[model samples]
Target: MTIIITGGAGFIGSNFIFYMMKKYPDYRIICLDKLTYAGNLSTLAPVMGKPNFRFVKMDICDREAVYGLFEEKNPDVVVNFAAESHVDRSILNPEIFLETNIIGTSVLMDACRKYGIGRYHQVSTDEVYGDLPL
Candidate 1:
């Protein structure tokens, strides 16, 4: 199965990819990242040449490009992790956060739906749930 993971070069996303690739060698994993400050190819350098791994540098908010990728890749599953995950940054500039988290997510979902993706997953921040008392 082909799985598309957005923001796959980020912290959590990168770890998740590592886990998936280690656990299931049979599955194909495609990474879509905008290469923002948080997204780094270096994080995924270890897995770059694997036969089942592919990377695409593109913004999730770009509808045309996203749809084109879906058409070209025909991914069977999608995982949305493309978002401005830093709460401190969000507090300073909420617009970028909204565009990445809300608008970007919507566009990706639309593309997934159009391509008939069999499964969809979202990796969201716990900050959205508010801080918990320790």
Candidate 2:
């Protein structure tokens, strides 16, 4: 199985990549990350040389690039963790957050539909659920 993981260089995404690689040694893992401030390539260094691991540096909002990748990779599943996640930054410049978080997600979904990809998983934080009682 080939899985494309957007934002795979970020904290949670990177951890997921490591876990998947370890658990499914025969599966192909493609990491698509824009290398934003929160995305550290070094975090994925451990799996860099693995035969089943591949990395692509590109933004999820780039429709053409995303489509091309989907066409070439023919991934069975896409796990999206891409977003402008800093609360302060989102408060200061909401447009960027909207573009990345909303538009980027739309582009990814469109590609999935166009290519007939079966699974598209979104990894989101609890913040979207608003404040909750513990």
Task: Point out where model 2 deviates above 4 Å.
Answer: 125-134
Residue 127 lDDT in candidate 1: 40
| Best-performing candidate as measured by lDDT | 2
Candidate 1 Cα deviation (angstroms), residue 115: 1.0
How many residue pairs clash in each candidate at the backbone level?
A: 0, 0
Give per-residue lDDT, candidate 2, residue 6: 95
The sequence of per-residue lDDT tens digits that candidate 2 reaches over residues 1-134 is 99999999999999999999989999999999999998999999999999899999999999999999999999999999987788888778889877778888899999999999999998764333345788
Could you give me the TM-score of model 1 versus the true structure? 0.90
CA error at residue 2 for candidate 1, angstroms: 0.2
Model 1 lowest lDDT segment of ten: 123-132
Collision pairs in model 2:
none
Q: How accurate is candidate 1 locally (lDDT)?
A: 0.89
Could you tell me the C-alpha RMSD of candidate 2 in Å? 2.0
After superposition, which runs of candidate 1 have C-alpha atoms over 4 Å from their true positions? 126-134
Q: Find the 10 residues in a row with the least total lDDT in model 2.
A: 123-132
